[model samples]
Target: MVIAFVISETFSIYSFNGIRIQAETWAEALMKKGHKVIKVNPWDKHNWEEYDIIHIVGPCEFLLQFTSSLVSKNKNIVFSPIIDTIQPKWKYKLVSYWGCSKLRLSCYNHDVRLAMKNIKQIYVRSQYEADYVHICYSVPLSKIEIVPLSYRISPCLHYPQKENFCLHVSILTSERKNVLRLIKAAIKYKFKLILAGSIDSEEKFRPIDQLIKKHNNISYLGKVSEEQLIELYSRAKVFALPSINEGVGMVALEAAVYGCNIVITEIGGPKEYYNNKAYIVNPFDIDDIGKKIELALADDNQQPSLMEYIQNEYSLDTCTKKLITSYNKIVSC
Candidate 1:
């Protein structure tokens, strides 16, 4: 099958969000499964109808407009709406259906009706996201497929060396990332913390830099190569990313496969993936974060269940199979 894995944008070689990485990963996974996959962005000039299925990869106003156009032509299409909002569900319903969208206040609201229009399938990263899509867009439960971001284990990716530090990988300056709060938690708990990933602005993140200098337990490594990242994950005792919100927390998933005790935000879908294995904490509470990190540090058993669960449930092969199954359903219709 020829597939167009479309996204709002593509990732740069140095920087990207979850959506870009997932799109690239899916395209590669599909190709390995004997399907022809094309990486497409909204601005790409190719004939989109040439593909067997139009698989839209993320949510944006422009992408919604393009998807609806394909829907009008009766084109076979599926969606990976990697979207979420911490705002009240009532606000979404009000703006989407009750004419509040015309005010042009909320970026999400103006295009939600368009986003909710005819599509054969909607794929999401977690059950929380599935519920969000259904509630916000009024999409049917059956229409949404939960395919969380995945990590496929291989020989080259190293194993658990288990050092005594907590690892966090994200844009350090992102307000939603909540890295500053996590730093405070680490300091409070007296745990060693290693910060990774690209910093959007050194100037904006100077406060964090100062904190790193003042506290020996906290240190930022900026960004590291894939090799360095795997090594860090392999060495770290605990992996923590207590963000304000996450679509599925792919970094945490990656860390879990390396056998790092997971301490992640409870706000998003990490709970569904980790289940009872990893430490789940409130993103807004510093003490909760600290306490959970402390608990995670104490879990020295290196229980094989969390690693096995992630490997079995979130393998790239499993993700591709579900995606292909959904693709077949839409194309057959």
Candidate 2:
């Protein structure tokens, strides 16, 4: 089967964002399964008829427009909406009333309706996302496939002896990531914190840099390599991801696999994975997040269980097989 893995030109496979990484992983995994996979950029010219299925990863504005065009051509398109957040109706209404770029909103609304009407299959990471796609986008329940993100399970070659600090990893510039709140919580709790990820710009990350300078306990390590990250995960006592929104919070899964105690928000994807095992916190409350971090640090009993569960349930092999099955079903239909 020939699959065109379509994504936005702005989406970098090497970037730390979950969607980009997932797109890369999907392409590689499909190829490994002996399927012909082609990476398609939205702006690039391609023979649309050459592929059996055009699998688009994220529902960004550009990709949405591209999908709409493909729908007009009646191509077999499989969409992974990756809807990170479902805004309330009132929020959309308010934005529309304020005339805050109605063109963008109009495009989004139109494209969502087009996808619901035309796309062959829609894939989502968690039940939360599946519900959001069904309710918010008005997509049929039958068209939605719940396929969780996959992570390669690697044995930790060098597990550090001292597991002392709390770790958070994400792109710092995203407002939805809520990095400032995490910083405040870390400072208030007096917990040693290490943050990893790339900043969009030095100017944009100034506040974070200032906070890092002011606090002795909080440090920004910029971006670490994959090996270094695994080592950090193995050495960290707690992994905190209090993001305002997330598709799956992939870093938390990676940390959990390394036996780090988790304290995550109950917003989107993390809730589906962590459930009752890790300490769940309200992202809006600093005190609650701090308390959860404290609890994670003090109690070390749950790490092994969490790690074992994630390993059993979310391995790359399992998710890849699920995805291939979905692809086959879509094409066969």
Candidate 3:
């Protein structure tokens, strides 16, 4: 069997990032099953008909044009849309409406519709997304299957000695990520807060800049290499990203594996996976979120042995095997 992966982004540099890791692990797993897998951007001008299977990693319509432009009815094309849903209760209606709009567009688009007409299988990450796809697009439940994205435990050389701060590693731009709200809470609680990853834009950064200057408790460590990020995981006592919405909180899982207590919003897939290991709060309630943080910081039993939990549930080998089983079933059908 020959399997090919088509993604729109540059694969070499950013491939190790969260979603790409699933793609890589799936390809590697398929190889062990005697399938030769090749990963390419669907937007790249490559011969598409040569492989036994062509998998699209996301729903980017641009890639749809590039791939279908070259080949007519590539029999093995598969759609994998990893939906990231993170929204507060009040915002669900608006988000669901937006999703419905996207679904309508997908049904009408020439490339996407053509693929839908020809493709035999669609893969989704969770039951939540699978149900949404069915409700929003009216795609048959039989045509879609649930395959959870498995995360590999990051290699740990040294664990940092944790102090009194909580950590957040998300794109810092969204007002819903609630960084400003977290900052105000930090001032009241006097607990240090460390932020990692890129801020959404410079305009959003301006207010954050003022807050950072005014308070010693909040430190912004801009975009970091993966190693440095893991180092941040090592030192933090608790990890929190009270995003208004999230597809799957990959960072939360990473922090959990490192034994950091979690404080997260009840949104999206993270709500499904938290499993009593976190402090789930209402994303809209800033004061309650702050009090939860304070309570978590003071709790003695907050940090459990998360390394074992992560290894059992989200190891690379386990996820790869599950994905391969789905692929075999899809392709053989």
Candidate 4:
């Protein structure tokens, strides 16, 4: 089978993007299984009908044009929107309006849902995203598939001596990541916090930079190397991501398996993955998030046995097989 993955054009490469990572992982896994996988930009002029499936990684306003182009040429396409609806519809609409007017987003809520209707299948990370797509876009439940992101564990990992600091990894300086609130929480609780991720812009980084300077416990590493990240995960006492939302919290899973106690957000599909091994907190509550981080730091038996469960369910081999089966089923029809 030949599959073409459509990459986003508008989003910058200056910051780390998990959705892009997921697409590349899936492409590598598929290629290893003897399928030809090709990377295609959304706006590129290429032979669309040559591939068995044209898989769009994430939804954007640019997708509306790409979806129409694919339907006119090939008609076999699937989309992984990664859409989650923790907010009420009213709030979502209000925020979408604000995004268009203030942030200059081309289109947010409506255009995204409209782009999925003509696609052959919709791939989502969880049942929550599947249901949201079905109900909001009026897409049939049969058209939505739950194919989660694969968590990769390093083959050459060595557990270092543990430290007392908590580690949080994400694209730093995003409001959606809620890192500012996390910083305040760390300062108030007097816990050592280390952050490792790309800072998107100097405008967004200014406030976070100031807070980091004022607080002795908070240190921003500003995007460490892969080796450095693994070492930090190995030595940290806890891993926390008190974000506004997450699809399945893959980094927390990696940290949990590496002997760091998990403290993650409560507003998404994390509960489905972490089960009882993680501490879930309201991302809006700084005090509560701080307390949960402290609680996670104090946990003695930090739930270091999640690796087997992840390998059995969310590993590259496990998810790639499911993805190929879905691809076959979609193309066959």
Candidate 5:
């Protein structure tokens, strides 16, 4: 089978581009399974008919035009929408009222609806996302497939001595990421916080830069490689991501596999993975976030080993098989 993976143009700027990572992983896995995979740039001209499947990852507003063009081609397109339902309700309402534009919304309302109508299959990371797509976009439940995100699990080479600070990994500039709120909570609780990932823009950088300077307990480690991230995850007592919107908190899953007690927001994605295992808190409540962080830090030893669970449920091999199964179904149809 020949497969083409497509992603938004802006994905290059995203430090933690989970969608791109997933697309590449899927391509690698399919290749190992004796399938030819090609990555197509969203903006580049391509012979769309050459591939058996054109899999588009992350259908945000940036890729709206590209997706619209793909839909018109009437090719067998599979989409991993990676939809997040935690956005403010007003944003949707604004899009509905004002219509599509580059300035107003990251994803145009009509583009999502049109893509859903034309796509061969819609792949989602969790049931939470599947339900959100069905409910919000009115996409049929039969069209949606729940395929959880996978992590590359390797044996810890040298476990670092555990540290007292809490670790967070995400782009701090995204409004939905809610890094500022986490910073405030960390300061309130007087807990040492280590932030990883690059700042998105100068506007978003200024406030966080000031916060780091003012608070001795908070440290920002610009952007770290995968190896360095794993080392940090191993060393940290707690890993927290208080995001208002998250597709599947991949960092938290990685942290959990490395044995850091997780304190994630009670959003859809993380809850599916960390049901009773990790501390879940409301992102909007600073007090709740602070309390949960403190609890996670204090009860690190009590947290169960997520290694076995992740390996069985969300390992690269397991998810790859699931994705292949979905692709086969689409191709056979």
Candidate 6:
């Protein structure tokens, strides 16, 4: 069977990284099972009828549109609506208006309806996401499946030396991610913090740069490669990414796999995943975030065990098997 995996937009800065890993893993896993898999982003226009099934990843309005067109032509297709918080408010509107007409979500209202119409089954990274998707799109429980994104265990990637510094790997975006709040929390605790990822522009991220300069413990490493990020994850004492909203918070999983205790916003995916393993705090309350960070950082028992758990549950092999099984089930139906 020839399978086409479709992704259009670069949804999350980290999303592309996670999807790339999953695609590579899926291709290998399915091929071993005697299936042909080809992964393509939305812009790559291919003949949908050529493949046994077309799998569409979320955040690609184009792919959603394309899937609807194929379904209209009576083509067999399977969809993985990889919903995340990265879909901004406006993009939702645009897709609702121009992409799929006469579609409205009885539960989630506008954007989710537009997102849900073209797909058959929605694949989410967590049970939390599955529930949220059900609420948002009013998708039936049977249509949603939980298949967490997988990570490759690379030897080159290293964690921080000890729990001396708080580590955050995020985009330079401020509003949704609330990076400034983290800077403030770091300042309040007077703890060392290292930030990874590039600024869209130095002028645009002036406030972040200013905060980094103001705080002696805050070090901004602009746009490190994958190798550098893995090394930082390996050595970091604790990982903190207290975002205002998140779908799965892949960084938390990556850090957890590296044995770094997590401190994350208590809303969305973080609240669901970090129950027993890490610390949680309110994203808006700077003081609360600070206190949690301080506690996690100060804990001496932080070990590599969390990494073991993540590797076993959310590893590439695990996600791939689940996804392939989901695909086969959907096709059988």
Best by TM-score: 1
Q: What is candidate 4's CA lDDT for residue 300?
A: 72
Residue pairs clashing in model 2 are none
Residues 1-333, model 4: lDDT tens digits: 999988676545635567787888899999999999989863567887899999988755577766866698888888888775587655554543333434545565656655666688889888767767766666788888888777777522433467888999988877778999999999999999999988769999999999999988999888788778778888898999888977787877777656677888888777667656778899999999999999988877654555445546777888899999999998898
Please, what are the lDDT tens digits per residue for candidate 5 over residues 52-157?
A: 8888888566445665677666457888877777664446534533444556444466567655656878898888787767766777888899888876657344
Question: Per-residue lDDT for 1-333 in model 2, tens only?
Answer: 899887666666554556777888888988998999888754678888778888888866665556667776646888887767647744533432332234555556555655456678989899987877776566679989999987655744333354788999988877778888899998899999999987877887988888989999999888889988888888899999998987788888888888889998888777788758988889999999999999999986886877878887888878889988888887787
TM-score per candidate, chains pooled: 0.89, 0.86, 0.79, 0.84, 0.82, 0.80
Residues 33-145, candidate 3: write the lDDT tens digits: 67898877545666566776788776555644545553474677777866664433334333333423346453223344344545667888766777656654456898898
* lDDT (10s digit) by residue, model 1, range 1-333: 899876654345446566777788888888988999887644658776578887877765565557667776647777877765777777866777544435744555556556666577888888888887888788888888887777844522444557788999988898888998999988888899999988778797998888889998888887898888888888888999898977677788888888889998888677788867888889999999999898888887654568877888888888789888888887777
Error of 1 at 307 (Å): 1.0
CA lDDT of 45 in candidate 3?
A: 65
Clashing pairs in 5: 61-106
- Model 1 misplaced regions, further than 4 Å: 9-15, 41-50, 98-110, 152-159
Give the better candidate number (3 or 6) by lDDT.
6
> All candidates: CA RMSD in angstroms?
2.9, 3.7, 4.8, 4.4, 4.1, 4.6
The TM-score of candidate 3 is 0.79
Ordered by TM-score, highest first, the candidates read 1, 2, 4, 5, 6, 3
- Select the stronger candidate by TM-score from 1 and 6: 1
Q: Which window of ten consecutive residues has the lowest lDDT sum in model 6?
A: 99-108
> Which ranges in model 5 have alpha carbons more than 4 Å from their true place?
12-16, 41-50, 60-75, 88-107, 152-161, 201-203, 301-304
